[model samples]
Target: MDIKIYVCHHKEGPFFENEFFKPIQVGRAIAKKQLGGMIGDDTGENISEKNDNWCELTAIYWIWKNTNHDFVGINHYRRYLNFAENSQNSTISLDKNIDFLLYCSQNIVNICRSYDIITSPLCKIHQISSPNNRQTAYENYSFNHFESDMKLVFSIIKEKHPEYYEASQISSGLDICFFGNMMLMRRDIFNKYCNFVFSVLFTLENIIDTSKYDYYQRRVYGFIAERLSNIFVLKQQLLGGDKKAYHAGQISLPTFTRTYDFSELNTKLGFVNHPAQTAIEILHGGTVHLVISFDDAYMLHAIACIMSILDRASVRDALTFHVIHDESLGSPNISIIKRIFINAKIHFYDVRNDRFPGLLPRNRPHISKNTYYRLIMQDYLPREVSRIIYSDLDTIFLDDIIQLWNISMDNAILAGCLDEGGLTQSRKLFGKTHNKNYINAGVLLFDIQAAKAKYGNLRFLYAESLAKHVRNITLQDQDLLNISFVDDIIHLPLRWNVGSRIYGNNELDYAYSEADEKIAAENPAVIHFTGENKPWHADSTHPLKSIYLHYQERASQALQHAQR
Candidate 1:
């Protein structure tokens, strides 16, 4: 009726010595009473003997696929079975099974601790007869290095945990096949079939192969058993015994990115250079979707600014907002803006500490790096919409702003603004990085259907391969768009995006200030505050602050009026 299950967390070898054992101890403590409580013992060690009360054995050890001696697997079989067959209590129920978490990444970790990674998890126990740690890099780093490289999953995880870098994904079989084993798994693949080859053979043999139960064998079985036990525990949990799944580590929920379907939680993230062709299709068709992303803290702020400008119409019905905070410093402020939106009817998605962007290599996650570049070329646009306006959240709207929707018919892809107007010398100081002729990625209107009809996935997706192949990649996104449509692009007026440097000057400031005062009378298409200056804070000196504040006041007023 009431039970508690704790999964094992075994850390192995010198690097992680007994790291996993501590949790097991705790599990045993918590799970010691009656037919319940697995304080720390992993259930894979469970062996059911005919019983009157409940369980024959307290735990079960999962026998992984990599038993070198082959004898250890037998020992595992016999120990569980003998315990199951000969237990004193006939009143106990065999109906209960313990859980273990073995297989995949868990398998890899077990192998690493026992001796070598590849052999322990993959190499069949037969061919080598005797396998020692083949993972020794110093003995043969040159010839053996290739094998170590195959551990792509572990490397990425390590990098992801501590804000390190991913080992980089290659296009070979690994790219298309691997879906991250990110979530914790409870039940292993064992339940699909009832027969265990080793389990059957040992029962008939009268004698257990005692020699097979060494340290290596123990380690190997430890991991395999761990996985199976995890699964069993999960089943029990869902079936209604106790809490079986605890995040092996603290986990954060992912931020809501823009998604095409509204019926379910949006899982994928969309990143493009401005609003490509697909964005237009959705808007024109009058379909609704949400795009969620967080590449930079500024980008998050930018989205807030854009929506603030859009808020004048008090139009919260058309869109929902989702954001994941990647950094700690800006989180409080971003949250304040979200609370304001919630009061006005904008849907505020739950943002928690579990998921992150800082963990990603380019500060971009969701899609692989190469795939993002391809988004620029063609056909890479999401098809639901032929095109949509993609504007960096930085810019503000001085006018009604819906006119851009009117421009959606045939995308000339009106785009402009670059490098904070050369105010930040860093882009150029990086030499080749600066060479790409900055086209601020801050604004873009995409024609999705056109791109699909034309080029295919572009130079953008293959930026790296192109960089290695073309020898020029300093501008990254800027370079790809430049080569793709610099000549073809129909330039939007400078008024849409006024650069920071020129706008910063005192003389020009007075002239634009007065001009803006008059322009405020009529709507300007969109006013982009293209740099560090923003209207959200008291310090933001953007010429359009007067306009942004106009909407903020209106949003508040609209909310009060609606309450009445």
Candidate 2:
């Protein structure tokens, strides 16, 4: 059988396409720019303008009107049906290797011989219902959504197709549902399903007043279609006696999108508007880009961190510093930095307070919103630049950063040393089944080209993944980074980022052994003040406080000389 499955996307991002799987842009009518080579749903006969409420249905409608194939399927950009026999029951797992999980057209054709329709496994309605509630489809819909709108849908179905109204009633009474609107079936069956789904949704759209609804609730028609899909399936089951019976098969797939509560946030970040400015430019060989984010409060520490790099780096290595900071980092500080690093290229990005209007409630007291500055680099940095080394302001360099930068990425998105907390923190963020070694986000070597190709819009990816976890964020951006790039990070040696946590605790909680940890601690390449006990604080008990103080004196002398 000739089969084609369209993966629907809202924005441009990393995607996979084969002969059997193609990319389609949803909401293209309202999108600012069309994704390069993907087909837009706005072409041909489409209700593309109503995508906000229709959701992915707009793609289905376009396919129904424009394309003709033996079998057709609809999947999301980040979610797809797993056709492999060995992992049929796995859902919500990371799509580390999506290609392996997907089967070819011949395999799908073989499976279709026994089943008429292929889709996600049916989930209990209460599993997604409002809190403390276990209700049937109708009751759950009314609780979570506008009750009147749902009732209106049922009435429209009763008036338009009375036979299916009985099926709708039967479906509403049951506690099972088909979420996400993903499906694959014969052309005939698909035509019938789309006709039924859009008919009811169009009628509801005309009668309902959704102007007062919030952005989420405005997507009412899409939510209604999920329940209607259940009605269509139940109706098919009821009519089987007169026909060759339709057999629906289930395949569990990972879903990347989830709903997040942004009530605590003042304003959500939209798109990148401003680009970073280079304060001073220098040209040299083996140039390495180093990025660090901080506020005025960390000026002394940030200066010491940068000086340590200059002090220890080889003359053969060229350096470029990208400083992302808030408004408080005044011109005096900028002048001082330029005077001190005369041979290096200095780029400054002055972020407004409004850029980060709100912070996550679970963020630790020591960690601030400044940590999120690294996430916005994807939008503002020059495309020509392919790599960056991001470090925290609370760190001191013991070895040349160019050495860390020169190491092979080996196809990983970023490379970093194992976190001091080891798998204990990993188990807390993800479940105990997590196998990937969690790396400290403080010191990382980012492969910019590969990461942008793999996951577009780093800030958006971080925001979406952060909402999926239920744990209290011990490290705000660090938690989000691990969640986003769980399996795509490379583990560097312990010497790269030896944390203060190891020096303070009697029982070391590091991923490396005691012997390895001691060796790295004694002659560390970079010392990270991981916890609250920082070297700058008067009462800090960090064993490496003296080393930091030595750099602090050097940084102070450089600042004074620049004043001259």
Judged by lDDT, which candidate is best?
A: 2
| Candidate 1 residue-wise lDDT at 148 | 27
RMSD value for candidate 1? 24.2
Cα RMSD to the true fold for all candidates? 24.2, 19.2
Per-residue lDDT for 249-318 in model 2, tens only? Answer: 3332333221222221112211123122222322222568888877667777888998777766664236
Q: Taking the tens digit of each residue's C-alpha lDDT, what string does model 1 give over 1-564? A: 111121222222111112221122212333433222212233444322211111111222232321112112111110111112222111121211222211112322332233210101111111011122132211221121222222432243244322211212211211111111112222232221113312322232223332443322222222222222322333334443343332221111121111223121111111112232222232455533222334433434444454544543223344333332224325454555555455432222223342221221242232223213223323222445454555545555443334344443345543443343321222222221222233455555556566545655543333433443232233344444554554345544434554433333321111123344233223334555544455667898554455556555554554344345
Assess candidate 1 and give its lDDT: 0.32
> Residue 286 of model 1: what lDDT?
51
Q: lDDT of each model, Cα atoms only? A: 0.32, 0.72
Residue 442 shift from truth in candidate 1, angstroms: 1.5
